[model samples]
Target chain A: MISNRLFIRLLAFAALVAVIAAIFWSQNPAFLSGGNIRALMRHMSVQGLAALGLTFVIVVRHFDLSFPGVASMGAMTLGWLIASGAPFPAAIAGALAVGLVFGLVNGIAVARFGLPDIVTTIATGGLAVGFSYFYSNGTSISQNFFMSGILDLNDKRIIGLDMPFAILMAAAGVAAVVLHASRVGAGMYATGQNRVSARFAGIATRRLIVLAFALCGTMACLAITLLVASSGAANVTAGGQLLMPAFAAVYLGAALFGRPSVGATLAGTLMMSTMLNGFTLLAIPYYYSDAIVSTVLIAAIAIFDPRLSGLLNFRKAAA
Target chain B: MSALTADIPQRRRGADFLMRYAFFILVAVVFVAFAILRPTFVTPGNIHGMLMSASIAGLMFLGLTWLIAAGEIDVSFMSVAALANMVTAALVQDGQGWALASLGGLGAGVAFGLVNASLVAGLRLPALVITIATGALAASIAAAIGLGTSIALNNTGFVGQVLGLRVGVLPLIAVIVAGLYAVSWFVQERLTFGHYIYAMEQNRAAVVEAGVPVNRMLFMLFVLSGVVSSLAGVLLAANLSSGQPYLGTSYFLDGLTAVLLGGMALKLGKPNVLGTLAATIFLIGLLNGAALLGWTDSQRQIVRGSLLLVGVGLVVFARSRRKT
Candidate 1:
């Protein structure tokens, strides 16, 4: 039954995307050019990776406000290490480690100590950003860093797709399989749906939550690596702007899928990236685009809940 | 059974006492530590600065206490304040009187508050999500209305001179903060509205079933929050002598920190105005002390962030322990 609904939604979304694409193409032929398409894909891939991690946390009915902090810290860590003559692999490993530790702290605070997820993540995120700023001395790192490997990886295309795009797609495929086909995935969904029943049914709900957070942290690290490599520098505010779009994508995915899923999230991410690219081509200011996206997100959430829609009707009737 | 019941009440009373006085004790400790570490911390000038800092945050905290007690949250108050400040400053820059311009700013805040109230109360959407959208929207509107980034206020105006006024050794803003706190205390502790707020937080269904207009009350509370926060923004602009688009960005976090650090429970509807005031003062003192000790802004932020985490953790832990 869920799959049937999912299939219908996916088809509808695809149709909508095509219509939007046509509109953009009419406005500017360059919107569909090969170079522009590749650039759009790269942008979508960066956002998708973060949204993918967020998908894991949100599926379990939790919010992780720490992703921006984690990404910035990871990027700064990598940049600082590479600038200090550290090996590329070592820098990557260090960044990953930082992400894992931060994720673990958040998971423990929420799952074990029963702290509110949003509050805990917000605090941890602030700490993470602070550390990044302190480490970078409040300046963007633009020193000589080992970029040959990253540049080469990005350049390596397969079947006319950027390497980063391929990696993101592969990640989404694996996530879909795990979520739809694996036992642990079932446990996670059950935990989110009803904790008491899941516990009664012998699921280690706390452990599942912790694992979800860990995966989220690791994914953030990978996303930041791509960002730093592509930009060849790390700024104190580097991952701060990704939070809103990532969140909108995650919720939109849930609205479409009737639940959170990586595939749905990737679709949502692509739609957003495409819309943003089109908006840019049309010379619309960034703020207007943000306002529109947030409105859509709120509307999507409202539409997904039958109760909320019913309440809206009742309000109208009263008025 | 009788003995167990008696013992439970006694234990609960003891816990309540500790919760009430914990913040005060923490404030004293912070004061002493700073005094010992930094020779200039106890000076009259630094003390005045700390009080002045507390006034703005304290006013916002007053509004937050009411909303949190009613089981709602508004993260957009800061944005509303920023928008209000910009409006007031822009009007003043256009040669309008300070009284009319400040009123205009407050009106803008009330307008935004109504939008929030309609969405949150009428539509039943989560307060957090709706407020986040409104906040972003408010910021965009502020930027669009020619308030681009920052604008210098006309310092020769009444708004500027009044905010800068001091009563001998005390700032006028501090007196306003004190007056606001007294009114809030009266509203929370003396009025039937306060009773309704607590009742709603404890059990919304019960309050609604008991003939209370829950939605209307919530709408009013949000408007009150908006008005107070905007007033803070106005005073902030007057103090800085410039209107900044991002001035209120840090207030949301700082307000939350003060509220939680003041021993307000996240799960319970307990309002602690005194504790909140003390927490604000403690936070300012800590920041001033850090400056005196020659710590960088990054280091101070790290300390503040960690303190927020620990403070919230302690409150949550205490609440859970009491439940057990």
Candidate 2:
């Protein structure tokens, strides 16, 4: 029962992915080899986890620029704790707690104090990076910390799938169910669509915004855990680089699905990961890859958002 | 009812006075505090150095005020400035004349600014998102232009002399910044365009109804911002005699902090040029004081970040309180 627009968008995205894959395969014969496919899946899952959280925030019409900061904070906290001989479970819990606190800070500043979400989150992100640097003493966390049970979790693959990918799938499934089948999700949509009307209808719009940010924070923590396991060390810049790609993926998903949906986000994340992988295989410079991805992001917004087109037409008529 | 209205204006006047002077008073107090804490802080030489640093940020801050006043934000200016700096430095390194190289850099800025304006004003996309993407794109392009991290400028020419110019202990860059501020003040306070900007801030619909060229104004504002940012970048390269690709990164956050801390309310959408200047000076002083205290770079960042949050929070809370 898919609408024509949705079907076409999906078909277009699929064909685009197919073309990119074929191009990469031609460039490198091992591009789609089983080994490379698994690696790409793992990379996408790690990135997809962060994008999923960001999708919730973006759906509420707020930008959580601090998510990368929260991720870095979580990673640094966990790495420092484990290096300092804390139990693995305690370290994980501590990192999640840090994420929760920062998320709450962002939520309160934006939802309660009425500060602009982007500006507030950007400041908080700086604070989080500061905290990460302070905690790590401006150096990467010791690699000895990676020898713990957390690293084992990364390798606990099922069949040919990575454990992180499995976890990402489960999380995505849960998020899809929560967003599409729950009353709260409906409230979230209502709040995002029209805050004043949602409030008039007795929806706690502020609470929903705060809840979305909190969920984003928790997801950042989860993503950091996998990131630390994969990288085997926590650096101050670990999470900052993830923000651009994560944001691009979320917006790309919103464009494809005609809404901010978890499934669309996963698809966008996988597409982005594949493109990045292809770029690497083709030996494209990092800056060019970034420029290309960002251009794609702008293109997605322009092409998919009908309101933007309407605005363009309005401007033309007025002129 | 007459008496009630009379009392309302009086109360509003009181609040307005407080809003306008609070940050200025804070700047004076902080300056005095720092001077008292470190005698060297009050020295003319140190103060000159601080003002020289503030000049670069102040130039960017000037443009930001206009952009924010138009109810739009351009985070891309910093990257534009950086890219412009790189272009100028690369050209100078290749034995091109400094004036021609500087023009090339400014041209780059105008070009990027036009792109930004098209997306933001023509396409009517969210300024925040558009500017962020443009900033990233500009920075990547700057990096891709064969400037390996930094480019050293040939500084034996007129450009270098202008950069190193001084009147007594005062740097010429500070004089240029002061001139720019005066021009900004004149524009914001006296010009008909300034009136349009204020009107647009108060009510876009009303401004449109009044037949103001809103989109064109925005387009011009961004172009002016781009040009000024390019000027700042050129000066920055001359001052350092090198162009660093990541030069303007810190200024992005610092410029925002300066604007917000200077009492420019996000809700009110009013630009306070003088307040922004004061905030820039105060930030420079704070950094000077931090250096005197021997704080690490991380500590300085932490302080700046916290100060920005508090400043923004206070403004938002104050606005909400006034509403209630």
Q: lDDT: which candidate is best?
A: 2
Quote each prediction's TM-score: 0.90, 0.93
Model 2 docking grade: medium
Top of the candidates by TM-score: 2
lDDT of 2 by residue, B1-324 (tens): 567536656777577556656666767887788789889998987987888889888987787888887778888899998899889888888889988999999999999889888888887777876787788888887787753478765574677687579977788888888988998889887999887877886798899889988999999988888888888888887878888788777788788878766645322325678778887888888889888978777787788788778767766666676666
Error of 1 at B203 (Å): 3.7
In candidate 2 the C-alpha lDDT for residue B224 amounts to: 85
DockQ of each: 0.53, 0.61
B28-48: candidate 1 lDDT, tens digit per residue: 887898899887999988888
Alpha carbon lDDT at B304, candidate 2: 76
Q: Which runs of model 2 end up more than 4 angstroms from their true locations?
A: A307-319, B1-6, B9-16, B154-156, B264-269
